[model samples]
Target: MGFNGIRPNATRKEVLEMIAVIMRDDNDLEFKLDSMNLSLSISVVTEIFWVLNWERLSALRFFAWIRSSKCRRFDFEGAKKMLDEMRQMGCDPIVDTDNYLLSSLCRSDKTDESCQLLEEMQERNCLPNPLTFEILIYHLCRLGKFDLVHEFLDRMISNGLEPRLTTDAAFIKGYFNSLRYEEAHKYVVDSSV
Candidate 1:
């Protein structure tokens, strides 16, 4: 920005372009540090993730960033090892991006695996909110986990999240697809009631 700044020679646009490259390159700390002489802060990481269109990043790479940021911020372990290494050197990953990965996994009928990821987040003190629980429960329902569906309903009620449109729709769709006409009609009738 000013004289003798690390990026003094680079225009603001170029600096942003460099950051974009670093983000796409998986936040190669060595390259970023060596070239930019800048520390990777939470803000920087967030900007990078957003610039990269967080949704486009692979789950593994996204986790890598999360783990990296965690390790940098609090020395927490990510869901993987290499990401921890990145954090060791100074990488702060984007939490929202990581949450999106969990959401995607939950929607994929990989609730068990998603649970593992959630556990990892919890270990890092990242407790999911109602929306996360809603997604997990909805996916479970879509996957035909009737028992778990009821269990989640109970949990959501206890958590003070009333059954929502998506929840009802998922149940209706699953019941209909399973040819449980009686149960589906019951739900429809109950909705009317």
Candidate 2:
């Protein structure tokens, strides 16, 4: 990832200058990236992301950006668009990346959008790990969306993810509150096995 003599901690103006040069030469961002062998380090990507104000970047670039920086403030719609673009580009984001995005969404109280992103992950055959399930289930439980919790629990079980006891307890309580006694009992019995 030669940055064409761009040093570490490049200023925003420098990054923009680089972008201008690339865009001027190719007018195709992806093509320019491919030509430059744009496997950038996280720091460089972070600098670029900050410079671009976290606009909807390409999937690979966005991944690098996220990997390089702490995304404390997320634009949910922008992140979702980036995920969709990543899928379209056939670049399946790793579970950790998804988890980071999920956590950010949950922190912002964007539970519904988090669920939608999880569904998108499923559609792409990107299996969610236990943490993924935990984040969504916890938020759904907080929102009193027991019906969704049950569905996510079912998916978790089918995916071979053993639900943590605490998460299951919350799920059970939600189920009961939602008058889903049968489902609650089913999970209780299954867990005891």
Candidate 3:
């Protein structure tokens, strides 16, 4: 089947046969998809992979591909579905997975969704690493959302997850940018203490 013809549960026997053949190969699904230049949506890809019973490694590859710069056309909804599919398949996302998703969301300027996902990660005990916080904090600060920066910083501290100096600086800069010098200076002092 041609790449453009690929869709969720494609009825064409050729497409089904081709997908099975590809899955049987040693190459990764994302590689196969990209090589074919398939314009398949994520849902279609997810369904195809699910039907092929290729979730374990395929989920990782899908997340990695979605996080890559080459995947400029995908969106959060698809990514979210992919993650959900992975979790439902007993593949709980790791910190790296969370970081990849978080970074992707931030890159897309979906800061609000990123923040919510960060909280979800915490609730799921898929703790965010320094890099995750840095990405969200930096983006929030850049957008002059100092309140969110502070809230995230506090959440980080409460969770005993120390932000790096650069993240702290971003928060401080965010405060100052919003003309909250007192809060910024206090943050510097409190963090130092």
C-alpha lDDT score of every prediction, in listed order: 0.58, 0.66, 0.70
User: Can you give the TM-score per candidate against the true fold?
Assistant: 0.48, 0.55, 0.67
Name the runs in model 2 displaced over 4 angstroms. Answer: 1-13, 16-71, 83-91, 172-190
Candidate 3 shows a clash count of: 0
Q: For each candidate, how many residue pairs have backbone atoms clashing (under 3 Å)?
A: 2, 0, 0
Best first by TM-score, ranked = 3, 2, 1
Candidate 3 matches the true fold with a TM-score of 0.67
Which candidate do you rate higher for TM-score, 1 or 2? 2
Worst 10-residue lDDT window, candidate 2: 64-73
Which candidate number would show the highest lDDT if scored against the true structure?
A: 3
How does candidate 2 fare on TM-score? 0.55
Give a tens-digit lDDT track for model 1, residues 1-193. Answer: 4423333344456548655555565546444434554334344445555555554643345345444444443323223444344355465344564566666566455677776776676676555565656676667767777887777667667756577777678788889877887998897898776
